[model samples]
Target: MQRVMAMRLRLLQRPVRIVAQSNAAFSTKAPEFSDIVYGQDTGVRTVQFNRPEKLNALTLPMAMHLTQRLHKIEANKTVNAVVFSGNGGKAFCAGGDIRALADNGKDPATRHGEDYVADVPKSQALKGQGLGTYLALTGERLKGHEVIGLGLATHYLPTSEYETLVHYLTGLEFADHVPQEQRDEMIHEALEELETDEAFQEIDPEYLETVESVFGALNDNDTMEGIFERLEKLNTEWSQETLATLKKMSPLSLKVTLEQMRQGAVKTCAECFQMEYRMATRMMENPDFFEGVRSVVVDKDRNPKWSKRDITKVTAKEVEAFFKPLDKDQELILYPSATAVTEKEE
Candidate 1:
């Protein structure tokens, strides 16, 4: 319990803000048909991923469409809970389609055609709606009832009862700008009748203890090398499997991920994104990015010939270079100010 909660808390504290606002900005009103589809059920808007054939893998256009719908929903005062589901129940989203990313070759710098929306105003930050559940899907990805143990999902309703639950929730007839407490109580009552009292199958109390025991982010000093060393010391099946998985990933990416986690821990959502944008634009231009996408996606081969195959091959300065701010004109425009967040060099 301690470890899972700790992991979730850490993730919540440092929300990942990688998605940048497209320059063209999506019109809230989407085309009549597209990869992303929308439906209305009472006050609830169901945003269903229509690419079931691709296991709901997101293309760039699909991502842009979904982003626009979300912005429109967030701004709509009449809207209630937004239900996100896959058109085919197999998977919500298998993840992004990186094959297209390889085609991107060098398009990131001018990847500024779409628009993005903002969140609740700063004044409403303290008294905002209570139903905005931030689901924590980390590491290998927790699924189904496992999310409840980590406080990721508010309720655990089975698929059998999903239709009825959605109907009941949407039937809720609250007016615009309802009080936070009242709105929460209404949802609590609706879910109480349907939420299955199913015990978590995978993430038991011991699971959290296991996560805490792992030499990862929970331990402040755990670098990529240190983590591998600690896992070796543990000598458990989990550690061995994790080691294998980490070994397959590009060394430079692993280092950058770890460092960014440390930096993002103290930065605001917007700040974190500004940092990621700089890193992303730079990464797209790197040879490693092309090699990775080619081997993993285009060629369908598991063998990725990374320039820096091992940690010894990647230097601190190389990782540090990714955190530097982009030019003011190229920076992510979250606010009117164009100042970028710079990493403090060691």
Candidate 2:
């Protein structure tokens, strides 16, 4: 166990941020629909999931709205950052509204204008929605400089969304090149979209290089097999705990912490510190955040007692309150120096 644990520790110690630098600008309001609110100022646009009646859970209109917004932001040079948050303080977003989705499926009115609505039978409406059902798919191609997803929605949302879009993009690429009738039979069809997309293809080389560099630094044998062994060891519970700690320890003061991380491989020490502090200040006051933590941790009641139990009841003042900094942050550590010696070396 110790040997296994030690290998895992060595492999997992390197800091790894899951998604790379494709940041999508968040649109606060659902432009196409009145119910959703969009916030755009400076370079950042926040698309607040406003339907509190449904825990800000998404609907088909919301998804279409998001897709259009992302496309608009990507086309605009002025906007560079975006965030996804919920209107009510309770959630960033509650995945998808299964009940609303089921209801929407039955209603032909809302389904009329959707992208895949024509291809799939009315009965299989929801299932035919494809990978775009999640948020990341709509935003992946636009590939903004920064994107931040607040609350529960941040989990696997971006990753799965990107993968799905990439897959379709690859498919479209193959479909474009081959005879229409023969396209489906391509042996490498699964990730063809991902493989061929200019944006996705661009991200892969960088990510592969990053992974290879990290693995090379950790593995003593420096062999292909050794790298796989290291990956295996580091995927255990201990590694996950270490990753969680790293996420918690991240410089929280920045306004767009997740966005900054996604943009590039490196940051100056000063830039990192400044952003961390800014983010921490922004996060200090979100009542929903506290409610969520309490529900999940302190109360153990499993149901969050929220500040604005209803999103419509939520006010701009309350959201503004979270942005107010309590005090000048104390002396803080700057970014990690690339030249700093690794613990493995020590």
Q: Can you write out model 1's per-residue Cα lDDT over 1-346, one digit (the tens) per residue?
A: 3433443344333312112223232112353556777766445677778888778877767765565566666666566688778878898877766556556545664443232122222212111111110101013655667767656577776788776656555556564556757667666655655655573455666645555555335565557677667668888887688778878778887777667665665566677667777766667667787888788666878788887869768899999998887787767777442342222211
The list of candidate 2 runs beyond 4 A from truth reads 1-32, 104-346
Q: How displaced is residue 271 in candidate 2, in Å?
A: 40
The 0-to-1 C-alpha lDDT of every candidate, in the order given, reads 0.60, 0.38
Instruction: Name the lDDT of candidate 1.
Output: 0.60
User: How do all models score by TM-score?
Assistant: 0.73, 0.26
Q: How do the residues 38-67 of candidate 2 rate in per-residue lDDT, one tens digit apiece?
A: 765443455667788767767666776675
**Model 2 compared with the native: what TM-score?**
0.26
**Worst 10 contiguous positions by lDDT, candidate 2:** 115-124
> lDDT: which candidate is best?
1
Query: Residue 310 of model 2: what lDDT?
Result: 37
lDDT of 2 at 341: 29
Cα lDDT for residue 307, model 1? 78
